[model samples]
Target: MRVTPPFAPVTDHDLAVLAEQLGRPARGVIGIAARCVCGNPTVVATAPRLADGSPFPTFYYLTHPAATAAMSRLEATHVMAELADELAADPELQAGHLRAHHAYLADRARYGDVPEIAGISAGGMPTRVKCLHALAGHALAGGPGVNPIGDAALARGDWSPQRCACARPGPMLDAAGVAE
Candidate 1:
């Protein structure tokens, strides 16, 4: 198997947790891509194609409510637009985004191929800055330098993965969305 996303094995508990985090059943998730300090899944690595056989382009999916909200806030404030301008002005940033895009594709390639999603990386990689959530997910899954836009988004966001913001799997909220 190819090394990818730190490879956190999936479990029934994980699936349940993801379902609650997503506010629905978490579909097409292959493994936990990143975790909160409390060990809850922050990001999940999804298959290029869902079980239903539909093409799913996003691989690293951010599920943490706090993190997702943070990214959304940044987007609301037009951080993506500012990042896009930076990407356009800085050659180094552009190159990093290109590399990030390739890395995303390579990581997804390890799972399985979906022709419909060929050459497509999430978060508007390689040219655009459309989604901070996607970029942040990639950054969280791959770590610092893997996705420049992701890293930048994380840096600017108020949320920090270093701290435990997870609701915790208990009466608080577990994968089943209920207390054990």
Candidate 2:
């Protein structure tokens, strides 16, 4: 499968903001996958392999603090179990999730083919819902219809991409989370 460019090139300023968001320098970043209303990175596209030569399976990584918190809250409420049950019971959702798994693999394949992590998509895709953060990240990055589980998580979350919940607006910020 071929994955088109729905993302922008990563820049130094983006790296700095990502460091602030992730609490570490971003690694194997392909581009900013999704952004907040104010342009802060919400999801990032990463390479299949990391700088340290580790096999990385997650393609769409969610970094927005508020969004991650929201997903965490949802997970704490046992929403992942409910989603997994739903995925098991609903045939359409099951099929869609399988396609989503394939799509995710295709997207990741565009970066590189890592033999160690091959046939594995993140967040327990095509089988179960393990991580809402990963699912929501993929949903946000690929847009509405790609991942049904991701869309469901995004729908259930309290956070909104339509609003700006970013730390700073324009340019890179300081360590204190203020615009520099």
Candidate 3:
């Protein structure tokens, strides 16, 4: 989609400040660069150069023009969507991230206080609100997802023991105490 910079008027004071920051001669070049960054044709498009006819050391602050522009609600939403798309595309990375998230959440569920409304089905508002309330117990407790075990670890220096999968206490017991 063809995106435009968010519309905002710049004053002479703003231009002066930008030029001072750019450290170039006061020829409005920095203003043009800002415009270019803001996705505007206002920039005079000759390659940036030093006063002595040498190339500028770096194309300082190279960024998507739209992003550099004055942010608007629509532009911000579009940028957020772009970032989300970038995050979602790589399956391996996404899976790894989700695995970490699942581990974190599962750990929280195990050792943390269960939310009062944990069992609401995912559907409409009542369900959603209830599910949200279920998660909100952490915040109500303090911050989000403060697990008792993790808290205990910090407070009492009680680290969880590592269990080797190959080693069992005995034959795996049933849900009850019956041997399985």
Candidate 4:
């Protein structure tokens, strides 16, 4: 597997883009974990604890609206249950998930340790497939092969990371609640 370098520092322009995309100010963001083909942030690496001291165990958070919507659709189809069954039957998948759990912990440790969330990874990792968003986020951050379940989910989704789906010349959403 290929190794990704530590996250780079967040920039003002990145913050502006993130704020525009999220429709709110980004909080506890340590760095951009992954970017879309259009150069927009798809995932962000968040601090273990938020500014208000809430323990946030999801170190990698999915941010792109298109990507988030895709994951939601996958979850709605009961894909998580199917993936959970696969995890239970496949020893190789189980081992990969365990490694992913460890990697996630190591990445979060760089920010700070929160006793409340120690040894816990997001999306029911290392055992079950609870949240596709978190799994996709981890896959995007770590790249392919790092999160096999995530990779499979992404492959099954309608969206493609290689393409830019953002509404051109403006924001993804408009005032009329339309997708641009």
Candidate 5:
């Protein structure tokens, strides 16, 4: 099932929130692909070609700090090799991954086609599980079942979309007993 929703235009407030989360200005952000439970952006959909005219295959970029940390931890364990082994052994998984590759391409095409990366998808998809971060980002943006490898990585990881792990304060209390 292709779970990637249509892109929603980025707003200035969304960019501000992203900048705060990333500790740098957000660039080439076309839309917010996924949001935290507290409504902050968790995944951003970026243009295939950056402003400087470089080909960036990572269309669904994970931005939530907690989620990124979780993916990084998984990567540190060298889980990609294990997952790559599984991918090689499972025919169903290989088919699902190919579908995900096509889905990723379709998603990137919406932003504008960049011929340099026409057949390429992020995270070494369809043939290898190279980057947990990119796969996890795709899972977050496309939701549960779209990318099998991505979904598996998310399931194996510690972070979840169901809960809010945002560093920002929630409903701050003011002296007047009103939320700030």
Candidate 6:
């Protein structure tokens, strides 16, 4: 799955389920061990929050670097799907809107993968094979284009805008209510 925001959270329940999935005891504590199957020793963490300053009754965020890195692309796809399933069942989530996230969810369904967490969703584009032309085009150009300024810059900064020869403040807030 494409690395999107909210890299799944690390709740107690998720660890429990993950342990069970790995054939470990359902009640034993499961911390990030050595290298992830993907060969990286990074584990990811997310924090699902509530209105109060304290964390919600749900989960925490932590990552085992090696483990997450070790995950194959296919394995990650399956894991993302499992996360979507759990998110689908969440009372806090708006289930109806989730249908639009099929690109991501379908991958999970296809691979029959389950997430360590029991209550989170994933969002990503579909992983269909690209046409040779598309690949060639991408190669001729660079890879996917990125917004030079990330979401953080857009949310809280007065970044310099791109323009023609003359430097000027570009327009803000498009008709569609997005940074154009």
Candidate 2: tens digits of C-alpha lDDT, residues 1-180: 325345666778778889999999888999888877666788999989999999999999999999999999999999899999999999999998988899899988878899999899989987989999999998888888888999998889899988888887645435433345
Regions of candidate 5 where Cα sits further than 4 Å from its true position: 1-5, 169-180
Model 4 alpha-carbon drift over 4 Å, by segment: 1-5, 168-180
Residue 176 C-alpha lDDT in model 6: 34
Worst 10 residues of 3 by lDDT: 121-130
At residue 144, candidate 2 shows an lDDT of 87
RMSD of each: 4.6, 4.8, 27.1, 6.2, 5.0, 20.1
- Which ranges in model 2 have alpha carbons more than 4 Å from their true place? 1-6, 171-180
Clashes by residue pair, model 4: none
Give one digit per residue, the lDDT tens place, for model 4 in 1-180.
Answer: 334437767778668878877889999999988877656678999989999999999999998888899999999999888989999999999999888877888888878999999999988987888999999999999988888888888998998888887653233423332333
By TM-score, the candidates rank as 2, 1, 5, 4, 3, 6
Task: Judge candidate 1 against the unseen true structure and give its global Cα lDDT, from 0 to 1.
Answer: 0.86
* Residue lDDT tens for model 3, 4-63: 122234445434434443345343133222222122222221123435555431211312
Q: Give the TM-score of candidate 2.
A: 0.91
Ranking by lDDT: 1, 2, 5, 4, 3, 6
- Candidate 5 similarity to native, TM-score: 0.90
Winner on TM-score between 4 and 5 is 5
Off by over 4 Å in 6: 1-65, 71-77, 92-180
* Candidate 3: regions farther than 4 A off: 1-77, 113-180
User: What is candidate 6's lDDT per residue for 38-109, written digit by digit as tens?
Assistant: 222122221323234333211211133112232333233454344345445653333322332332233223
Per-residue lDDT of 4 in model 3: 18
Worst 10 residues of 6 by lDDT: 145-154
Cand. 5 Cα-lDDT:
0.84
Is 2 or 3 the stronger prediction by TM-score? 2
* Native-to-model Cα distance after best TM-score fit, residue 153 in candidate 3, in Å: 29
